[model samples]
Target chain A: MSKVPADLRYTKSHEWVRSLADGTVEIGITDHAQHALGDLVFVEVPEAGRSVKADEPCAVVESVKAASDVYAPLAGEITAGNPQLAAEPEVVNGDPYGAGWLMRLRPAPGALAAAALLSAAQYQQLLDSEGD
Target chain B: MARQTPLFRLHQELGARMVDFGGWAMPVQYSSQIGEHHAVRRAAGVFDVSHMGVLDLRGARVREFLRQLLANDVARLKTPGKALYSCMLNERGGVLDDLITYYLGDSWYRLVVNAGTRDKDLAWIRERARAFAVEVSERSDLAMLAVQGPEARAKAARLLPPAEGSTALTLEKFVGRELGRWFVARTGYTGEDGFEIMMPAADAVPAWRSLNSLGVASCGLGARDTLRLEAGMNLYGNDMDESTHPFESGLGWTVVLVPPERDFVGRAALEPLAREGSPRKLVGLLLEERGVLRAHQRVLARDAAGKDAGEGEITSGSYSPTLERSIALARVPAATAGRVQVEVRGKLLEASVVKPPFVRDGQSQI
Candidate 1:
């Protein structure tokens, strides 16, 4: 089981959204996703200033075995993307919620309400049900 | 469905990811591929290769029968406990399967073949064995484990029966002997020092537990794939099959067109291929760009006509932990090498062409 923080909002694709008072929403993949694709070797985060819709593929997560796409949790205009991921992709594998945050975005107001996200418990329940 | 090996339950208990390899349910990986790969390189790792087929042939004319059956001359295995790598082929020279035949005595020999093509290999060999009256039997009741690494021999020696320890260590590469209940062979696919032990099914669990007690880390098929790829070893389905001959798949040396008196399957077809020349040859490629190479990706090699040889495909590839770069074994034109582009997705990733068996003796030779 992976750590799902109470303060973070969750997407079914296993991404966490951290909203700040300045209206910039930080995005990163959840811990569960990294554990599935172990030992990250390379990561390709979206370029800054690229506008993407909800569920858009904004980055690529590459492991030693295979490559996968990182989907955006909500509609937003990319404000900044992590540059450190290029050299030290293992940071994403280690601390996905903190230094591993993929990108920050300026969302259209009401584009992503708090109600659209799931709580940690709700996400865990969803995972449990999916496993069933 | 095919039969499951003795380690099937153990794999499930360890949360190993299982896939149907041919027909057998085998673990592809347990935790991470890179970690397991590194373990086998630096220290030691164990693999459950019981799915592989073991055929025992015994008769007075066994050697005579093998001379006519296999492509490689078996006269090399004159001494007891010596093993020879050879290819079983059709009369025209198309490969049936590549295998290792270990000689225990003049009257007995054991052949180990790939898991996927076991049935076909057995049927083909047995069909011909009837003429020589050599008995062929598939030993499904036995399970095999490969413990490989730099420290593999020492670890295994400490775990084997005390009386047989010295003999087990004394066994040369490509040789095997019966040490009580276990058949210990000093051979490996990882390009490292190790032993592949075959034991009766009832004894497999105990042997595995004993080895685990000796601290041999259990690895899955994922590690095996990367290890073999780095070692420049060939996988049956990916590297070659019935459709692909040995010449184009980095196995041209294994075929013997000499000794005119000897004739085997697919010789006629391969003779013309050798005479006219094959268009492609298998080579190792190190990805210069930042990406992973995979099977079926197009290789853009400049051809003799000076045009891009429209398509060459990667047979096997993985991120080599020892070399810290992505490497692949690809089938390209005989004239390929130097600068070539591998098509990963839509992008043409540049790679350096070099000879294979990438890492030998824990050192990157390429």
Candidate 2:
């Protein structure tokens, strides 16, 4: 089973979002998403200061098998993309919740609340319904 | 429901991630595909190839039957146990399937064909053999395993019966020796020295387990594909199908047009094409960019003016684990040369055209 941290919010597409004290949110793929991709070889993140809408494709994660798109969870303007991922894509496979964070975004007004993102328990239930 | 091989349960026990490949529930990877690919290049790895169809031919005219059936001259097999790789073609000179035929004796021969083409190949061979009174028997009761790498031979030889093991060690490349129920051949798709062993289905699990216990990593189809691609070998459906002929698919070397009068299934159509030269040629592409190349991607060969000279398409492509770069095999216009560009996700990335065999014997050849 994949880990769903109790403090984070998730989208059905498997992007996890964590709110910071500065009113910005950090985003990365969930453990389940990374595990399914298997050994990421390249990551192409959006540029800093770019605007993105909810559920829009903001980045690409490539494994040996195929390339997958990472969707943005909420309407937001990108603050930064992880520079570490350019040289070391495996971080997404190794530490998906921490160093593997894709980008940071400052949300548009009321975007987080309007997004209807799932809570940790709700996300776990969603994963459960997709039985092995 | 997808079919399962004899080693399916063992693969599940090893935590393999299974996928449906040509209606067979087979492992795509056990742990890591890249790791398995490296093992086959540096040390050793074992692959369950039981899904491939094996056929045994027996008749008074077995040799003559093959000479007329295959594009390559099986008459070249003067020594018993010698194997010849050739393409089985249609009357239009299009490839039906590529197979390995092992000459066992005057009246006996063995053939291993691709998994997806099994039924079609069997039916075609049976129809063709009727005139020659040859019996084409599918060895569904047999299973195959390929042990590959620089050290694969020495490690796998220890598991065979003593006398057979000694013979296996001394066997030359592309030769097969039968010991009891086992038929071991010194051949592999990976560009490494190794053996492909075929035995009874019941013996597959024990042999796989023994090889695994000896540190031969268990590889799946994912690694198998990358290894073959790096070796510049062709995958049937990806590289060539009924629409493509051998001369245009980088398999010209396997086609024998010698002795002029020797007629085979596709010789009538291929003869004129060979003399006039094929309109297209298969070439290798080395991408220096960060993106992975994949099948069906469009390739553009350009002239000095940066204008389109000719177009082509990538048949088989991937991120080569050994080269740490993306590479592909494409069928381009016959006169294409120098640099080419492959369009990936709408962006044209520059790539160099070169001869294949990208990696061989665990070393990068280009």
Clashing residue pairs in candidate 2 are none
- Which digits, one per residue and each the tens of the lDDT, describe model 1 over residues B1-366? 656899999988878878899799998888877888888899888999999999999899898888777777787788888888877776645567889998888878889999988999888889889988899999987899999998888888886777798889998888899998889999988888999999888877777777778877888887888899989999888888777888898888877778877676677778888898888888999999888888888899965455666568898987887887789999898888586899886788999888998998788898
Specify the highest-DockQ model's number: 2
- lDDT for residue B317 in candidate 2, whole number 0-100: 89
**TM-scores of chain B alone in all candidate structures, in the order given:** 0.96, 0.98
- Chain A TM-score for candidate 1 is 0.93
Worst 10 residues of 2 chain B by lDDT: B301-310
RMSD of candidates 1 onward, in order = 2.2, 1.3
Overall local distance difference test of candidate 1: 0.85
State the lDDT at A20 in candidate 1: 84
Taking the tens digit of each residue's C-alpha lDDT, what string does model 2 give over B190-236?
Answer: 99999999999999999999998889999999999999999999999
C-alpha lDDT score of every prediction, in listed order:
0.85, 0.93
Predicted structure 1: clash tally: 11
Candidate 1 ranges with C-alpha deviation above 4 Å = A114-117, B91-93, B303-309
